[model samples]
Every structure is written in C-alpha cells, then in structure tokens.
Target: MATTDSDTTTTDDTVLSMENVTAGYGNTTVLHDVNVAIEDGQIACLIGPNGSGKSTLMKSIYGFADVKAGSVHFRGQEITGRSPQANLKNGISYVLQDASVFPNTSVHENTLMGGYVFEDDEKAAQRAEVLYDEFPILGDIRQQDAGTLSGGQRRLLELARALMVDPDVMLLDEPSIGLEPRFIDDVFERIEQLNDLGTTILLVEQNAEKGLSVADRGFVLASGEIKFTGTGTELLNDEQVGRLYLGG
Candidate 1:
C-alpha cells in the first residue's frame, strides 16, 4: 500500500498506530493510554528501564495482553485487541525475547510450523525454499534438532521462521538477549539487513545504545507511558534518554 502525506497506512509512513490504548494482564494494569506511530518499512524501537512496560505494549499489539480501552489501527483499520491468529493473518509477525522454537523438533519442522497457516501446501514449500536460501544456516540444519543448536543459531532460526510468513510488520522483543558479544552484533546487523529489504520492524531492546543506533525512530516507555519519541539520532542525543536509559 503506497502511502501519502495524509494516509496513515502503507505509503512508507506510520503503518501502525495506537491511540490511547489501555491494556493489561489479569488484574494487573500495564499500559496506560499508551500511544505510538510506526511508519512503513521503518525500524522503530522501544527502549526503557526495567518495569517500564515495554514488553507489555509489545504483547498488547501481538494480542497477548487484554486491551480494555482505545484502538489499534494497522493499515488504517481498527485492530484493537484482535486475536493472535487474526493479527498474524493481517501481516503482523512477532518474535519473542526468548527462543520461541520447538527445541525438540528438527529445524526444518520448526520452520514448517511457520507456514502452517497457508492453505496451499505447494506454496508453503516454495516459501520455505525462499527463506532457506535467505538463511542458509536453516538449510544446513534442516534435519538437526533445534535443542542441540547454540543460542545464536536458535535465534537465527527463530528469525528465519518469522520471515517464512513474509510479514509486512515484524515485532521483536529483545533480539539481543543472552547472545555472546560477537553474535549480538551480528543479530543487530541481521535486523538492519531486514529493514533494508523493506520489512517494517517494531523492536524492544534492553541495550538502549544498540537499539537507538539502528532504528529510524525510537520511543521511550516509562511507567507504561511514552516519555519520548524521536529519530534514532535524536534519541541518542537527547539528554534525558542518554542519562536515564542509555546510561551515557
């Protein structure tokens, strides 16, 4: 969907919008009127201190949290509190902070799970082939059980599986978690490569410097409310973000 100056969907500008959203877990409120705008093919990040509700917001968007108020609009349509399956059908995919793959399953089977939503088996196979080429490690490990792979390898497999859907918007929770320093850098590089290929990304990062570094726009959530929103460079330069989150 090509976007215009006025259109809020697809034209490479603000494809996702959350307006006055109030959502939470059972009896535990997490987000309070949280609002944000993510543009098309943009790498948008959320960074904050612990207990800031960054994960809560990500879960809400992915339909894991209960939305009590407000609306979530994607591609200019209301999707507030939609089911997880519904969100996936609408071109949204989520990769959680931890290893979300079936560790006991072979890498190929794990990846095949990603294409289960497709109706045509042949098309699914073709999609898997394309992703296998894009992520050759997955191809090599197609017969290997995911449980035996290292953390970084598993992380890569998880990402490749997410791309199996060819999602328009990808939500990532702490893609750098628990990775060795070398692999951590590689992970961020892979994320940048994805963004360069026109995949929209919404990321939650514990490493504020790295998060704000690669992102086009960054948001700060403190106490379940957005404290700041700006370009990655601007966020890195901001005194408040630097002092509080980035520890600069």
Candidate 2:
C-alpha cells in the first residue's frame, strides 16, 4: 500500500490532532509539517527509527515541546502551547519513556501522585483505590517502596499512576521499552485494556510489528516528517513499510 495524506484529515470523531505542527526544543525543531489525527476510542501507533522525532511528537502534544508553528487540538478545542500542568488538568496524561517514580515513595503514594491536579486529597486516594482494583498487583504491594519494584511492576505503576486523572487521552512514550519479553506482552495487554475502557491513546513504540498489531491506526514518521498513514493492517502489510521500518 502506498502512503497517503488522509491521516491528517480531522473528522467529527477526532479526539486529538496536530495540524501543520513544527515542534522541538529551544528553537531546534525536530518535527516538520507534521499532521496526524486520532479518533475517539482508537489506539494509534507512531513508529519510526531512533531520532525520528517520535518522542518529540509525544512531548509536543503534552506541552513539553515547543510548538513553533501550527496548532494542536483536543476534543475540538485548541491547546497549542498549553503547559504540562494545564494539560494534565484538562484530562491529558503522559507516561514518559524514562523512569518517573519516586524511589523512596510507597507504591500507593506513587499512584496518588497522578491525581495531583485533584483539589481534594481524599479524591486522589479514592482514585488510586479504583485503579488498584484494575491492577491488583499494585494493590497487593501498596505499602512497598517504589524502588523495590521490578521493571514490569514499575511500568504498571506508571500506567496506574497516569490513570489517576482518568485522562481522555494518554500519550505513551515507548511503553514496552526496556521490558523483558514476558513483561512486554503484559504491558501491551494493559494498553489494549485501557483503550477498551474508553481511553484514546497515541503511542510511540519501538517494536514496530507488535505496535501496529494492536493499533487501530498507524503512522510512519522519519526525519521529523510523516511518511505513511493507514489502518494498522494496511501499514503492517505495506511492502515498503515492512522492508524498511519493520525490518522485513
């Protein structure tokens, strides 16, 4: 299948979108004329080689990167250049690629941190409890120090914490990165479960095949530009995409 520009077209169902966005850090642009839209209740995957601005794109959406041009919209409202704090308050949660837990904090406490935007402490605690019900393993170790968790446990903790806000959109940067094969599958399963529960997700994944396997839509980006866009299966089966990005 050949790449098309239709992925940039936003529709009534579009929950998150970037139009002609040029973003990067401190005047050093990493993305160029990027256009992508994620529909409501869909799992969209962005796959590219290292240094291809995948993480930058995630940051751009979450207000971590500077959008030098164009606009970003969420639920039809413009949010270009919004602060990270504001973005979180507006129901956008980001799970970073790097370690993000407090080493000395208890597991339950870390989970509560996700609801920092909540005006009441009790509500945050209640939200954490609800998340624990969805992630029983975290509930079982609520008292353990975050530093003591395994890699997979830490990843799950990150996911649960991010959900503290009950976000409408989740920007997951390399969710399965650095995990063992066993843990990787578990993380992906959790991602699917989240999508099933009504959270629209935009994921930047290193494992091209596995990422697209679960994605409802897929985008291929390179050198700070979008190169392809289609249904997950369409991109996965594309001869060029397979030979280049998928290592076929």
Candidate 3:
C-alpha cells in the first residue's frame, strides 16, 4: 500500500498516482508539479501537443526519468526513485515508445526476455506459450529472428513480452506510432483486450483522436502541466480540446 502525504489525496480505486511530481532527464526538468491519478482497470490516455511532456509523464511513473520532487505511488505504495527493475518486480511494467525487441534474437527468445527477473525458466516458458497462443503471429515465427518481422509484428511481440510479468498496470508510450492504418486499429484492439483482461493502462499517444476514442478517461497536458481531465467521450466533445489537440 502507498504512504500518503498531506499534499496528496488518496482516491478510491486509484491504481497509480503522481502528486505534484517534477521529473525529467538528467539536469533538466520536463514535467513540473504534475498531478495525475489513474483508476484501476481503466484505459487512460495522456494526450498533448508535441514535446508537451506526455512521454515524460510515462517515464516518471516507470522511473526512467529523474524525479526532482513530489511522489509516485502504485496501488498505495510509495515508489518514488525506485529502480525500473524493482518496479517491474512490484507489478509495474513500462512499454517504451521505440522498438524494444532484440533484433538478433529469435522471437521466442525476445518473448522469454520479458521474464528476466524470474528465476524459473520453466515458468517463464509457460507464460510465453500462453502469450504466443494469444498472439499467433509470434507462435508462427517463434524460431525466426525478430528483426525479420514487420513493424507491427515487432510491436505485438513487445506487448506479448511485457505481459509475461502479469503486471497490475502497464505504461505504454505511443503504441500506435508509425504503423499502417490496419495495424493501428489492431494495436488499439489489442489494448482493449488487455484492459478487458484486467490490466490498468496509462498510455501516452500521439494519435489523440484514436487514443481518446478507446480510453475510459483522457488527460491533456500542455507545457508539462495537466490542462484537462475527463472521460474520453467528454474530452472528445470539449470544444477547446478538440480544436487544440485533436486537429479540429
């Protein structure tokens, strides 16, 4: 459970919380006093203009960026400044924006790598089998080098790998970036399926329209601070949000 500070309020069903968090890469801050909370089992998206710290928000939660101030909590436990590996063990998984799979390794190997924190290879293999079953394309080329797969296939493999940990919350950065239209739809559907299966998702997406279309709640960030927070449909209907961020 997370320890609460006077500055931060605890809300029921909040799986993740960032209270006045100021974080960024080394020697520079991208996010400033950001307060964002995500409820359990909801597909929440962070959408903003380019360089609005949308990606930085995900990094802060995953511990990739340096937190200069404030707090980060997962399921009521304080995890500020925790190493990424430690957070992963504690059921927080971060799927980064760029390609994260190993090009030289076999697809099976890449999937198994998700469980590097596990001591039992057999257990990891079982999880990989389940994932392969869910993502049949990974099964089809289990022995092939991951580099040989198409762009969308590689992204799917990354998601399958992330699931090996059975994380409570998955922080995904730009899952639909650089994919074909069909593949983009497939990615969103996969996100829906994952959320349906009980994973709380916090997504940072460049495709605001499509991202908000599937999200239960939407957050808009501008200049490193949260500008709007509402249900996806609510933000979609907001005239200001639509005009500024959704390319109206």
> Pairing residues by index, what is the TM-score of model 2?
0.98
Worst 10 residues of 2 by lDDT: 1-10
Query: Which candidate's TM-score is highest?
Result: 2
Where does candidate 1 stray beyond 4 Å? 1-12
Name the weakest run of 10 consecutive residues (lDDT summed) in model 1: 1-10
Compared with the true structure, what per-residue lDDT tens digits does model 1 show for residues 89-115? 788999998779898899988887887
lDDT computed for candidate 3? 0.89
lDDT: which is higher, 1 or 2? 2
TM-score for candidate 1, please give it.
0.93
What's the CA error at residue 91 for candidate 3, in Å? Answer: 0.7
Query: What range of 10 consecutive residues in model 3 has the weakest lDDT sum?
Result: 1-10
Misplaced by over 4 Å in model 3 are 1-10
TM-score ranking, high to low: 2, 3, 1
